[model samples]
Target: MDGTREMKDSKQLISNIQAQYPRLSKGQKLIAQYILSNYDKVAFMTACKLGETVGVSESTVVRFANALGYSGYPKLQDALQELIKNRLTTVQRVEMANEYSDDTTILNKVLKSDIDNIRGTLEEVDEKAFEEASNKLLNARKIYILGMRSSFTVAQYLGFYLDIILDSVHIIRMDMGDAFEQIVRINENDVVVAISFPRYSKKSFEVVSYAKEKGAHVISLTDSIFAPVASIADNVLLVKSNMASFVDSLVPALSISNALIISVGMKEKEEIKEHFDDLEKIWKMYSVYE
Candidate 1:
């Protein structure tokens, strides 16, 4: 893709969840705003140095990429590289990199930027919307988890934790074809917690769309209001997780998932008890309970 197409793709990842992203923390929000405003710069930075410049840990950079539906920092960089290589002339790209050359001052600047982002996120988060989404998870008959690439980790985590609290939590982490096949089992009583961030993986969106079509309630975690999954989502939880770097972070997104899991745990404490009771028997049989 040309630079314009690449930039458009980057924008699409974040814009798709813009409305919901503001619920993230101040630092995470800072990262999100930075990515949007300085995407051209980020198309080239290494994850480690990117985190340093953004005043966040390297893990945060990796998490940020995960937040955006990338498997990790390298994948986000690939997307950035695609944008940079196809979008800008070599000379122009070089000129742009020189403009934001990493410096000690970047730390302070990134901190201030994140603070601003957090404030904005706080202002934009829809409390009632989040509550309604959580309620949906608590009441749903089956909870289906959809995520791919970077999002797969979050989906797996949610599925594992939610399973302890409720029965029938399904996670699709393999091929897109397999995911499509699994959603066929969804029904009116099922709810899908679908996660897709920047570079918003096409497969993730497809799964959400499929689940919705099957009459499953969909909850989305994405970066922007216009996130592709939002339109089909029954509820959306947004996380602001941009920073001045190449990678997108997942801390905020994971935090959102954790919150939902906690809510489910609270609502179905008895189910958790039964789930653990069965697990203990397996643990003893496997010598894990010694």
Candidate 2:
């Protein structure tokens, strides 16, 4: 097989398993079911543990990997890890959390996972992409923000700050009956900042598609290049959101948003200062602050 084709095939682990399911032996089928259902745990499991969990011998696990075209068990495990790094659902994460519940240091372990996520995000970030996203936001005639479900909070936070320094900033709300209607007026002069995480919202992807059709520049903040939005985005900021529980970590996403906001603010310092000055006078007049 071609190297490129091999890489692509390896990434589609679930699909490969399903395609080969009919030919697998009873023991291999047991292993396949367990892996397909509990990939999060399987990704981090030792071959021995995996076999024990599925009621198969340790050697059976290695045989299963070879059956799947991997050189060995470790190679197969690597492919599983790659598949779930950004695509695990909240339920899957909760399953992972339960695995660590018996540990006396569960709290530390969870926090350590978050720290590693942030560290990995920073190390893999593309400097050129970050700068391009910031520049697009600063120069756009209008900016629209879109996020749904868990991602809504991040979008709202970005819009809240950007609203202060930039004119014509809008947050496209899903509750508006027709979210697409909100961006119908978008054009080449506008920019859309979209945020999405694992089990990504379908509505978010629709918004990006609509934005692209309207010729609006799109800056996406997502967990991986495999994210649907990343494929269509003019600029993508990858942030690692792996966590030990049902909840997705937003620390790194928030940090990236903060950087974008600050970068845009610095570029328009004089305008921002004027806006702040006007707001300060109103706050004083209305006694809005102590």
Candidate 3:
């Protein structure tokens, strides 16, 4: 179904604010105006900071988010961030980072944020979906993994280990030419693992669209349920990746990839031993490692 009907576009936030604008109190009106004028900036600001910047109380910002139908200020901020993620420039990202530069030491803050991301992801990840995706990988006739930009690293990591433990694994790369060229033979027996996070790559969505059209089983790993690829996926695994600075946080996503790899290995126990044994023989014969 592609979840298009269920998709929440940036328009939803804007329209919600506009629709309720006339009825808003003076304080809420200030927030609405500020958000409408400076969403990219506000996306990175905490509710308290946003309120202070606009000469309102912190509670006003919370109520304003609630009035717009968001569950809380963080959700509202997240929605705003989603709207700008794909469009934000490096300079804009750096500017946003400057807002919190003095909060704590860079090293400590970054590490703590990653810890929170993983902890949040662990709490929210759907167990049934993870198991189902694992089963698909185990049973697939052929497996194709796709990701672009920052996500490409994660795809490579997953593909590396899976190639050793499984048969017919293909990692899609668009470097030489069209990535589709590699997946041209994909069919119902094939499984496509698509990874994309905030500031998603359109190419990833294109690959998912093609896989779906060909009746391939599709599994998506993304930070949000509303992520574009989520609609078409047979199973969706959500990984938490709260924004911190100019760089996209991918540690949690990589951790999920590791979990997937280990799960597949556990299920097949003895089946993949011979594959590794033969590969080790080739490595030793060629002195691949000292």
TM-score of each: 0.60, 0.76, 0.85
Q: Where is the poorest 10-residue window by lDDT in model 1?
A: 1-10
Better of 1 and 3 by TM-score: 3
lDDT of each residue in 1-290, candidate 2, tens digit only: 43224335657889999999999999999999999898878887879989999999999999999898886786686567667766666666776766675666777776776787788689767789999999999999999999899899999999999999899999988787688889889999999999998787887898899899999999999976778898999998988776657787898999899999999999999999989999999999999999
How many collisions per candidate? Answer: 30, 0, 0
RMSD of each: 12.5, 5.3, 3.6
Residue-wise C-alpha lDDT for candidate 1, range 267-289, written one tens digit per residue: 77787778789999999889995
Candidate order, lDDT descending: 2, 3, 1
Q: After superposing candidate 3 on the true structure, give the runs of residues whose Cα lies further than 4 Å from its correct spot.
A: 1-10, 100-104, 273-290
Alpha-carbon local distance difference test for all models: 0.69, 0.85, 0.85
Give Cα distance to truth, residue 33, candidate 2, Å.
Answer: 13
TM-score of 1: 0.60
* Residue 281 accuracy (lDDT) in model 2: 99
Residue pairs clashing, model 2 = none
Say which candidate scores most in TM-score.
3
State the lDDT of candidate 3 residue by residue for 1-290, as single tens digits. Answer: 11222226444778778889999999999999999999988987889999999999999999998787676787787678667776777777777776455646777777877997898789778899999999999999999999988888999999999988898998898785798888889999999999998677778898789989999999999987668898789999988777657787799889989999999998888888877798899999999999
